[model samples]
Target chain A: MTEHPGADVVIEAQNLDLTFETNDGPVHALKDVSLTIDKGEFVSFIGPSGCGKTTFLRCIAALEQPTGGSLSVNGMTPDEARRNRAYGYVFQAAGLYPWRTIARNIKLPLEIMGYSRSEQEERVNNVLQLVDLEGFGGKYPWQLSGGMQQRASIARALAFDADILLMDEPFGALDEIVRDHLNEQLLALWARTEKTIGFVTHSIPEAVYLSTKIVVMSPRPGRITDVIDSPLPKERPLDIRDTPEFIEVAHRVREGLRAGHSE
Target chain B: MKQVLAVLTVVAVIIAFWYAASVPMNIRGVLVEAERAGEVVDPPKAADRRQIDEFELILDNPFAIDDTWEQERPRLPAPHQVAEELWDTTVEKKITSKRSLVYHAWVTLSATLLGFAFGTGLGILLAVGIVHSKVMDMSVMPWAIVSQTIPIIALAPMIIVVLYSVGVQGIIPKAVISAYLSFFPVVVGMVKGLRSPDMMQLDLLRTYGASKAQGFWKLRLPASMPYLFASLKIGIAASLVGAIVGELPTGAVAGLGARLLAGSYYGQTVQIWSALFGAAILAACLVGLLGLIERAVLKRMGMA
Candidate 1:
């Protein structure tokens, strides 16, 4: 499970340094944090609270500009990548427009990107079916359960088929049963679509359950502690979590997470 | 039993006082006839027995249209009399009839709707400007609040007079007045509504590479629907006020306000009351109609 140099690189962060000039003082969120994600790779950023996992995701999405060092996505600077619409971002919260129905919510990104009306309709329908929300297209966001709402948000991200998918703990608010269910569905979707995914999460098992490559991070000037590569096979079935290799990777992730939290 | 009798007695005593108070007023008119009939009458003050005259008139049914002393003694016609007058003049008469309340109401309604439209449009436009530019926000927001503080009643006449000087008569001046008063609420409401999206949502749009205009059209405008409609309801009410005020200042001869004035001139209390009520009903209907439109638009947008 060592680094595959021949893998297709989608994003490369070189000596990244992100500092915030708050009223208190200069607070460094990310110090010389560097990583490379391959095309079609399922990468997870897992760490203790306040470890800048969300911040790194935001910076990669071009929602926040990195203060120092170069961060590139799809061979362009993050800002250029943003202008090129190279990524789809799903925030921790569903962030669904309450006024919009499930189908229309999914179509929001496509609409903003100015897809033709027919294209928008086609993409919306496809994504809605992908999320298993085919019959709930006309239902409002408020009317759906929290899990369904989150799935709709995922559908929204998937609608545009961007090169990179940036997810900030997309299921941080869902219950455990629903979380497990979605995790399997997500892995299945990723396997089918072959899209590069960058997920941020705080849970060790959840991280181990989904990630092909897990970047373990620590707080206090957030830096990567250990990069855990899963040898548990890329084709993740729900029963894979019960396999010896999957359990071994999960234990390694937990140990790395513990060390990261302690220090 | 004693307390009940005492309460009844007190009520009787108040009635007696009320009857006594009207005696002088009735006698002043009634004694002129007694003197003409060569009755051995006392002085005007002593013969001023309005209570006795009222008692006799009530007992004999004064409005019975008898040959002897045929006259209706109406200090103030009762509620039923006013209703009858209103029905005869407004509903019973044709819509084109001058005395018809419906015609007057229509005139006032047209002015109100025109003013409301003008006001709401100006309000939304101003709100967009204020939301987009800080310079306009600082310069116009203060003036908007100050303008409303000037009292629409005070400004309505001036608006009419100025518009008249420029040969802008009919409903235009009234609509302008309505718009002036109504736009403030819309501006305020829209500004708050347009700014409702949080930083994350804005960043989401930014990451999507949406330009400012695109972001507004796709995100900001849809988000502001609830606030916009809420403010519109208030603006429409203000528009009605502006129209009514507009009519008061101008010599609007065919509107509800004109009817109010004509009724005042002749001391026709019932006419004035009826016109006021009709104007209220018209305003309510106009506001309700706008609400229905708002509901329809929200439904189409899937917001409600």
Candidate 2:
């Protein structure tokens, strides 16, 4: 059983090491990685490309087993937790099936999880409403804009009622204007759902905008260098990032990344 | 309009050549009958006013009899003669008559459908096995290709004999032979289709933490429909060939193949031509039916 949120830890890792045995030689993907994510807390992992942030995300999702180390999600192993439908994952790309309409795709998890027909329909409608895509349920994935596709993917994950969201570069494929709009909408959703999110990205501002705590990672060694807590208020929007308080936290995250670069 | 006229002209020239080629005098014949042990195996039948061979055209001079001695070339038979014969053999006499195309066609159709179903089922099952297991990928796939390369005619006699000795008779043996030859395309096509989900789509499923079976059912199967249907078209054609070959080896009592055998023995050129056309039409109709089913199912799945 997963320990409650107030029990002080929902995710904990100790001395996590991952290695890949390829033809070239032994490639170290992650080393001495350790972290914690409190329940209902929003955290973003940002670093240079090939920094093993995705590896770490996948390790937590049980898609990849670490070469060595102990990792736990709400006390259970990632695999066990996953079997229990514990986390909802959003990928770097929208990854929507072109053949399926928005409503049907959102119903995918519900089908696998064996929801009743009425419940499946209800949850799909609810999530579509949540993502501001209520009227667009019947539209095919290709018919929608890139941002809309991403939102549909989010709604798919959100529809399943999982408390944790593992978003790997969810808005990485969208343009700046759309990205900004989605970031604000995401923050609003986060505030409403209070999901414990693990977001991976390369954009510094994006990490700062959504994160309660920003984990700065560096490549080569591929380990976390710093975890900077945000001082900004919980109620945030695009304008919040322009404020003095937000800039200060952003500056600290930058320093943490710089420190990672130096060390 | 000009294109239509050109096409008609081409058809007319072809027909004229065909008429000249069928002139009786040009035909070479030796005995055209066989007898063994003083038994009449196939006796020469009574010749009508016209013989099919090249000499009959000059002898009869049916065309321009009273006029210019210009005989209209003797036709192989007007197409209507063959059609009337076919209708008489199939619909008029039905299966009870000795010269029934209906009985023979039924025999062939039954085998083709049985074999097609078996082959389709086997192919789908093998494709699933390949998609799921590394052992099958390494083992079953290589052998399947080699199996196709062996001349099916050589293989048919062996298949028929072996199955018959084992007490497997009638349609099942023939169908199994058909299936054996027909399944390879479906297996290859479906395997490719199942593997069609690339790294990006897989990564998406991974992010969702979908189980292996879930990934297959939700993504792989749906993605494979177009490939499966395309393969079905080829697979169905091969199945018909397999069934006909199966019938040939068995010295089939009733089938289009049997008609060919009977026609050859009796020197009935029209019978051979008509039976071949019937088989061709049957194969086309079966393929068309599968296509209709494919379109309907894919549309329902929203994959059209």
- Model 2, range A1-263, lDDT digits (tens) per residue? 14343545767888899998889988778999988888888889999887789999989889889999999987799988887777888988887886689999998878877899999999999998888998999988878999999999999999889889999999998889999999999988988888899999888899988888899998886899888888878888688878988888888878878887887
Instruction: State in Å the error of residue B21, model 2.
Output: 8.5
- Over the full model, what C-alpha lDDT does candidate 2 score relative to the true structure? 0.81
Task: List TM-score per model, in order.
Answer: 0.82, 0.80
Across residues A81-190, which tens digit of lDDT does each residue of candidate 1 receive? 88887888988889898878888888888888889999998998898888888889889998889999999998898899887889999999999999999999898888
RMSD of each: 7.6, 7.2
Q: Evaluate residue A137 in candidate 2 and report its C-alpha lDDT on the 0 to 100 scale.
A: 95
Q: Taking chain A of candidate 1, what TM-score results? A: 0.95
Off by over 4 Å in 2: A1-7, A97-101, A138-143, A241-263, B1-103, B198-216
Model 2, residue B192: C-alpha shift (Å): 2.8
Candidate 1 regions exceeding 4 Å error are: A1-4, A98-101, A138-143, A239-263, B1-82
Among incorrect, acceptable, medium and high, the docking class of model 1 is medium
TM-score, chain B, predicted structure 1: 0.75
Clash counts per candidate, in order, are 1, 8
